[model samples]
Target chain A: MSDTTILDQDRDAGFGDYFALLKPRVMSLVVFTAFVGLLVAPGAINPFVGLCAILFIAVGGGASGALNMWWDADIDAKMRRTVKRPIPAGKIEPGEALGLGIALTGFSVIMLFLATNWVAGALLAFTIFFYVVIYTMWLKRWTPQNIVIGGAAGAFPPMIGWAAVTGDIALESILMFALTFAWTPPHFWSLALFVKSDYKDADVPMLTVTHGRRVTRNHILVYTFALAAVAIGLGLTSIGGPAYMAVAVVMNLWFIKGAIDIWRRTDADSEADSHLVERKFFKFSLLYLFVHFGMLLVETSLTPFGLGGWS
Target chain B: MTQIRATHEIHGRRLSRNIGLGIVLVAFVGIVYGLTIAKVGTDPNDDLGAPWAQAQDKAAK
Candidate 1:
């Protein structure tokens, strides 16, 4: 009886648990960026197929999320931000998640191959492996440079979406990749600023944990500067236009200012939530990427009427 | 002890709940699967041979 209770204490079940494992918030970003990539490509991709590709991309992203939760169940239990995930909450067993993840992985890629070019399908397969193997299992727990390097997995969606339609990669797609890659460190470190103990307790070596808050802040500022350059540079491409450039200019300024503000502040000064400026910046950073990517969709669509590209 | 009965009841409740949760997961996968194949690759074959084949064909005149 004691042993049964012990085993049972290790589990919990709820509908929300599996949903949480999907990392819906992260999947939303993946979908938004992938959709922008699809919309902005320089050809007439079938809208239905484009929509299908986006669906599969979103599912692929969710599969990665599920696999990540399965792998990180140990540390996820310790972090308040991650403690409620399916595996950690005992809603789903790790084996079940792995099985689901693998099955979804196969379905997304194979279905995509049937619907799109093998190029796009191959890219999808690599992305799953990149996030699950390279980032989650290897880089994340092993290195402080995890987000900086592992950031590539999150960045590849736009490229994948572009490949889905074009059956090839392009400069515009790479720029889209660059936008998300450059934005990740600052986005993550800022959250780490507030949840310092979670990473520490979880024994995960987030930038803030290994390098101290000051260093992480400085790194955020640096990445923000690089991100600003990428955004503005993207504004000069064939995919760029007045709408995208306008969004880029405004968002870049705000993002850089936020990073700069964080860079100049100390941990002791930021401890009080009464100000909430850091939290505000972190939240804005989320919207910042979405709006900029969303604007690209607007810009590209507007091209038919002479509102895009150097004009 | 009375605690033993409570623990057993809790475990029973959890197993039932898990099976229920599993059913929903199955349904969700079916939906995503149906949506993926039903919607995506119908004309995606065009994207492969060349970009915008249909549009070009329409304007060939």
Candidate 2:
């Protein structure tokens, strides 16, 4: 082949392609929650140290994403939503992803320990392990309850963040962890309801694929109720205030209503509307978590003025 | 004579990767320096530090 022809077929991955392996979107959520967790904790942290801690935590989360991409490349290639990911898209090699993941995992964990405290570092390390090994490797393909249990990995960031400041876990941090843990199932299962075919095609036993859509919808409703309790319960904690309570109440009510709408619909109903309700619920779920965490930050900001948290 | 191209699409990708990595390294250095300063400037009587020193002093006595 001529040089031009050879170059055309090279398909060398770009910076963006490698960044995609880190799952930057998911990393953003981790960063945000971890930031809130650090800020809302009872103690204070140096601003520079806090920033570094969050950065390392985000890197740890992203490392797990790279590892997950490495392991799930096969199924990812089959799913339409993930087919264009770095590995499956032929832009990056799986081995390269594995290497990057391991390297970043080590670097982030060690740096986090040095920047903040052992508790934060250890939590980040555990989060990476739980997500990559437990969630991605073992539980994901094994059972329908994958999302329910695997959600713990995603839920750890805030706890880790709190640990960065306090060097210990507390009721407030656990509540923060529980809030995300409870939110994960409904957030994901809603998307699964609309994307059932993707899971089926990839032979992944998502709740929707293993159980019927009706059961999945029921699960979404159940989890949404649980999530509402956690969200409201968080508002009663030391980190929560009247502003947070207001956000929690309104968001949870809207979330529960969305879950009810999904639960009431059949496949036929969804088909007629092209899964409009499910899509809406899934989209709103993102906003729900963001608003909840944002309010917590607002509460923290209000503390100096004697307006934040319950005295 | 056949003309040779100066740059290929692959070059662009390579350049981007290099630039991205360069920025990440610079940021990493800044973070490490800042963290070191923060850790050094902290009070020895703070949370993680005080407990260890108090225990050591008790043992010595």
Candidate 3:
């Protein structure tokens, strides 16, 4: 179905093009969240082991990206936003991406099992499977709420990280997972609102393209409310402290206000401003997740010095 | 001109292939180092430390 040619390209594909298939931006989030999860747990990991766990987790996340690109090459070639991706741009073949993704997936999972524990390794494998199979192949093109269900894949990193330390999952890690899960819908929906055309042109079943902007906006607000609940609740947990609570309260307030503002705007208003508010909301959503996770890292690092995590 | 073009293409493919192989090699070494050569924490609860500490306690006895 993909029109992007695998051969006879005018120019040779470079190393960077292949690297781009790993979706470094998404991998960074996986790395950071997984690192926070590992560090904030109640035990000390060898520094090298912890670093290795994070690295493997990032690789697992990247493997998922490459597999996703391989499968979605057809839609990617059509969508304005994704047309520049390596596979879609004819820089790399679809089969090559699939092979690389599978290789990394196996490598990361097996090595993580050896370096850390089976629980973390299993979680990483499941994350890759869910993203590639459940999200990329099945739900993405078929459901308007693709991201809502697919969000679980992105939410598993911190849990995997936590498991890496304790060799088990617990309430604290689940709460961290919940934080990301609940945040996903609103973040992606806001982007979908602004870029509905891309989804429509690609024939993707994004909420905005299928249900219209009004419905998408309402869903964003609803999910934002849910996200705020999770974000604020996380602060009350043992791993979270006064510092986290402070960050959470401010960020959630601002986030909810942004969602509400988006909910009220007419499409005409959006168009007049060139989707400025929608764009700002989308950008803020990125910062929102980063700040929350960054606070967790800060709290964890400060704990040894008598300054973090619930006094 | 065709010969020159073909050689350039061969060189490009070789470069890309080598880089790909290099990445795989690096990833393999990193994983091996982390798995075999690396140590966890010094606490008894830490994975590597626990076994070694038990051994030391036995030898001391």
Candidate 4:
């Protein structure tokens, strides 16, 4: 697949493939959490600046995805999960992907600064660099620990949301970062467990590939525990309220229970069975993060009424 | 193969296009500002976060 010559030259760019390169699923979470962070923060930002900040943040998130796809084009072509990606299908060239990613990354960071503050802008810059240079190029092939550490890049949006308001980091913002950072391993490993073939085919090192399914399951359980703790702990903070805490308690339990089911499964159907236990958890994981953050929005909404919050 | 277009060939086209696109972007921003000043100093609503109006009530009061 490194041959690059293998790409289908006849394919034209479709809206969906271009969208796929942006990794809209990941972008949505980034937008949602960043939006919640902006909402919960104690200060005010101009509507124009706030919109630009979110736009740039979304583009930065998308840029990270493009670069990831570019660097992994070789591996991506080999895996069933990504074999149809724009570059692999020759709908977009690897070089095009790289150019788009680098330009957007620079544009996003600069736009973020103009729209918001330097602190948020700087964090956006670091997040893009870390995801591309640090994780994709350096860590992913070499270590199963890649996602665990690289997860920090994904986790920065909420903090960026906070910084955009306060122009600095706050305990509340850090807690949001911590919550997402802690949640990453379990979220990714669950997906890895089901699609172990994707990693194996790509020659990528994932926890399920390196350590085996049971260990992967155990890792998911442990990380899920830590993530749950972080979510609940945020409830005890200035930002959290009865509404947020209630949502956190219910969602975290649902998440942990999902992880537990994955752990207890003795049969993962390694041979094309595509272990549904982890698959189920992976799908739930996306909903888990969105709902948790959405609940924060709910708490903010109900704060005036004084009925649905912690304080 | 009918004709071999090297990677560099496609990339050269993209470079020119992007550069052109970037200049156009700058021009667009300038137009927005120029028109605004010529008319009136109108504030644009570009804020992305939730309005402080809701959170103000929930604030640590």
Candidate 5:
């Protein structure tokens, strides 16, 4: 069957199928966060250097995605959520994904080192390693806390962006990292709440599958509380201002309320409602991070006019 | 004759993919090589050492 599928795909697959293996959605997040990081840092970057840095970082992120797809193809094929992916759908060979991933990894890292400082280059390399080796290969299969620990891989892009300009990690970049890291748990767990069975089917040991919905709900509420603290704290930093603080306060309040609502519901209640609260919370989580980062970018863009940041 | 045509079609696709991959690989190597030269040549503080070392010496004084 696999051979037959591959033969069919050999005739049908196009460039798009191959590109899908790079996970462009995830790459976009990396690009935006990294760009924000670079722009908000203290020093100025040569526009050319900055563009190259973000491009290479995006490639590194795509490399990480390709490698993840390659490694997770087995379980990915089993899950409804991932069954249509390039490798799982037989649109591309697993070996091709692996090769593309490795080639891009080397190309991105080397080019980034040339384009910017080693600090950013090294961080990009480590992010890929953590995502591919730690999260995808090892943790995704081994522990329920996989997303919790593995979230670091996703959180590194802003720091890499900051390092691209500043050449060092500082309190500001660390805080930026903290914001994303804190936000990841609640964001992912909310999705897990709705799709617990997918994890169960894939045997990926997500928090929901291993701990049950009640514990997962409680975990979501707890992580949301932590995320609020980090988000609110970021507003007090130099990069933040009235604009960011206002958005942060309102969003965090809404986020916390959503978590509490989710926490109070019984699984039966959720099922009766068709997981409405969970679905809404999951969708809102996307905006939660986006607005927070968008507010930061807004504030930074206003800085040249002397109207941004705390006085 | 039909079986032979199908096999030929499969082989043609495979060959096309290989050629595409080869071109991409070559382009990637060229980009890296060009960027390395540009970066090293332009930045006195780059890893190639001599130019950057002289710049650092000038800065120290």
Candidate 6:
């Protein structure tokens, strides 16, 4: 075979390549949040049905990832962070990604409806639409607030999970959704502070690129305060307990300190340390969300033992 | 005569894809079966004490 053929063969898409189109890391967040949502809601679902609900919600989330990859392949190739995604890396055809995304969207929605209820199925469908159309196609390139609003797409899983069991929405689930929604802006803006050039080069209007890092830092600080309010407020809801309240208080304090550290620093300080505070804040944000949700799960587990929830 | 090798790079990818697809298909079948059993066993109409069915009966009356 010629050298060209050899190179082509080496680059041929594998099963893993197609799986990567689903953006598994992001899907993991979807799975976790949705699981917490289902379990914490005030209803009993069969363990198997609960598992299916989480699985289908994850699949729906992954379908949106695939669709996002398909729609954003152009700008994805421009960013160091996303350049190696399946489509941008040439491992999968755009049409293939589109087809897989559409196919999974349908299958997941229908299966979730069958296994759970129409509420969850409808929420999943709307999430796919929001991520693909509203976020990817419209807001991403057009506004600095892209992630601010686009965060809704990621925040829906818990609500969908709650709906799966209860077949309705409630304040507790809405609080869960609000916790993630409020968390997104700071979580993303912190990363954008460090990787500023990626969005600039891609011509995407990220807060860091559009408003400058100072403003981005300020936004992160403000949003972190809002997030703290949401987090603390969630602890007052039906799902909150002693454990969750403690976790919320401690994590929010730490998060606020990190945000303040980022806010107080000038570009000189950040550049001197290679954005250490920003990067640290970003890393802590991940743990922050996980601990909060994990505590909620803990509260639910303790409920049967009469230790969980406000009641 | 030129021999075609079974262990070519592209062939390996194809094989992995096939195996991955097989696992997913099997898992899907298992999930569907489990879901069916769960749905049927917990069906509100099948259980006299199910609050949901009682609520529905009350609403109908």
Best by TM-score: 6
Q: Which residue pairs overlap in candidate 2's backbone?
A: none
lDDT of 4 by residue, A1-311 (tens): 45454344234454455557889988988998898898888877756567667777898999999999999999989988788888987778888888889888988888777667799999999988988899999998999888887888889999998888889998889999988899899988887766536677777888777887788888989999999989998888878888788778888998999888887777535434557667778998888887888888888888778865666
Greater TM-score among 1 and 6 belongs to: 6
lDDT of 3 by residue, A50-133 (tens): 988898899889889999999999999997878999988877889999998999999889978888899999999999999989
Q: Please list the residue runs of candidate 2 whose C-alpha ends up more than 4 Å from where it truly belongs after superposition.
A: A1-9, B1-4, B43-61
Isolated chain A TM-score, each model: 0.91, 0.94, 0.93, 0.89, 0.94, 0.95
**Residue B39 C-alpha lDDT in model 5:** 59
- The alpha-carbon lDDT assigned to residue B33 of candidate 3 equals 58
Candidate 6 residue pairs in backbone clash: none
| Ranking of models by TM-score | 6, 2, 3, 5, 1, 4
Model 5: lDDT of residue A273: 91
Q: lDDT, candidate 3, residue A122?
A: 95
**How many angstroms is residue A158 displaced in model 3 relative to the true structure, after the best TM-score fit?**
1.0
Worst 10 residues of 2 chain A by lDDT: A4-13
Which should have the higher lDDT, number 2 or number 3?
2
lDDT tens digits, residue span A1-311, model 2:
79976754587888999999999998888999999999999877889888888899999999999999999999999999899999999899899999999999999999999888898899999999999988899988989999887789999999999999999989999999999899999998888877746777887887776678899999999999999999999999888989999989988999999999999999999999999999999999999999999999999999999999998
User: Residue A228, candidate 3: how far off, in angstroms?
Assistant: 0.7
Which is the winner by lDDT between candidate 5 and candidate 6? 6
TM-score to native of every candidate shown:
0.81, 0.90, 0.88, 0.79, 0.85, 0.91
Supply the DockQ value of model 6: 0.54
Candidate 3's displacement at residue A49, Å, is 1.0
Best by lDDT: 6
What's model 1's lDDT at A298?
A: 84
Question: Which residue runs does candidate 3 get wrong by more than 4 Å?
Answer: A1-12, B1-10, B39-61
